[model samples]
Target: MYIDASLFMGMHAAVPGTRQACASFFAEHLRDRVWMTYEEVGRCDDVVWALPRDTQDAYYPFMDVLHSTMPVKRVPYTEDAWKTAADLPGRGVLSLRERLLMATVIASDSRLVTVNPRLLNLADQGLPVAAPENSDGRHGAFPEPLAGLYRTSLALEIDHARI
Candidate 1:
């Protein structure tokens, strides 16, 4: 299971109680299965780069923990993926990175777990997409914890092109 930057940020910035909850959740639930993408780790690296030297020093340990604990899979952006992305309807509006990410997911035939569902809705252009069950705002109940984990893992696999 690979995690997106949103989930990483959520883990990083969650409130005390939430952080503990997440820590407990992850420790008890995802130790062996969870994975992260090089892109997502790169996003975290971008955050580190944006910080001041002293701040970076202070946060290095945490970053190390994230690095050592979560395996990061490096997936290249292939030519076919790029070509497919170019044909997407919102290609002009989407950022290059976003397009590559979306293409990577589609080409891999993996599920995507994004807060933005609209991007996935543009399936007319041939992008294979999936989102959390309740994300459409139609489901009344929250998904089961394991189900959420599975969804997250699926997203990661997509992002990492492991599928």
Candidate 2:
């Protein structure tokens, strides 16, 4: 499943109220497969920088855990993913970062797991796309990761004809 940055940074936004929903969301959806986009990494880092730097730098410890211990996968953005994101009909409606994350989700063949209403709109319009088997090109295993970007070379129909 694709994860939104909010699920990460919001859990420790240096604000208790912000974390309540994020914590609840995670506790309720424990078993879903999860991945984070490069955009999300930057967003999380943004949160880290915003925190008051104490003697121990509390956020780094959490970032270290995210970078290592979490079962979450790190998916990089590639040309194909960019193209997919750029071509989205709803591109006008989404924030630049959200578009990238959604593109990564589609390219990686995972359902977006977000509490973001904008992305949920795509789900409502039928996202969580998988490759088509009939050779419109998305018919096989993904290509090897190019540079930092992961396997999304296989052409995919991003679930909704409208999106």
Candidate 3:
């Protein structure tokens, strides 16, 4: 599954129970290989660096621990994914990064785990999207046929005609 930046941000924002929720979610799901777009990585960095010095100092070490323990594979934005992003439904509502992240998950044949309501709504449009575990230890419903991990890497297709 592709992890959204919001989940990572939640780990350090000090929201009530959010840190524990995100941590538990990561601890359970990140046991296997997971996917993350490079954009999400950058977004996480930017958001973390913008926090107060004390938060930054604490969050960086936590991020380091996650990096050491979890197997997160960062994928680059591909041309095919970009095209799909441009054509995503509700394009007017999502920001460019959100669209690209959604498209990357689609092109890779992977599911997205996000808390964003707008992105979660895309599940109805045939895009595989789910939410992280809630405070009550309940997981969000994953859209059918996409609950399982399909690929280890981004599945980009090449068009010979375009070459």
How far in Å is the alpha carbon of 145 misplaced in model 3? 36
Best by lDDT: 3
Q: Candidate 3, clashing residue pairs?
A: none
RMSD of each: 9.5, 14.2, 12.3
Worst 10 residues of 2 by lDDT: 147-156
Ranking by lDDT: 3, 2, 1
Q: What does candidate 1's lDDT look like per residue over 1-163, in tens digits?
A: 3345544443333243323333343444334444445676687567556656665665565545544554545567777778877766675666676667776766666644443334546554565543323323232211354334433332111121111
- Report lDDT per candidate: 0.48, 0.53, 0.66
Lowest summed-lDDT stretch of 10 residues in model 3? Answer: 149-158
Q: Candidate 3, 7: how far from true, in Å?
A: 1.4
- Which candidate tops TM-score? 3
Give each model's clash number.
0, 0, 0
For residues 20-53, write the lDDT of model 3, one tens digit per residue: 5654577566557888888888877766565577
After aligning candidate 2 to the native by TM-score, how far in Å is the CA of 142 from where it should be?
34
TM-score comparison, 1 vs 3, better candidate: 3
lDDT of 2 at 46: 58
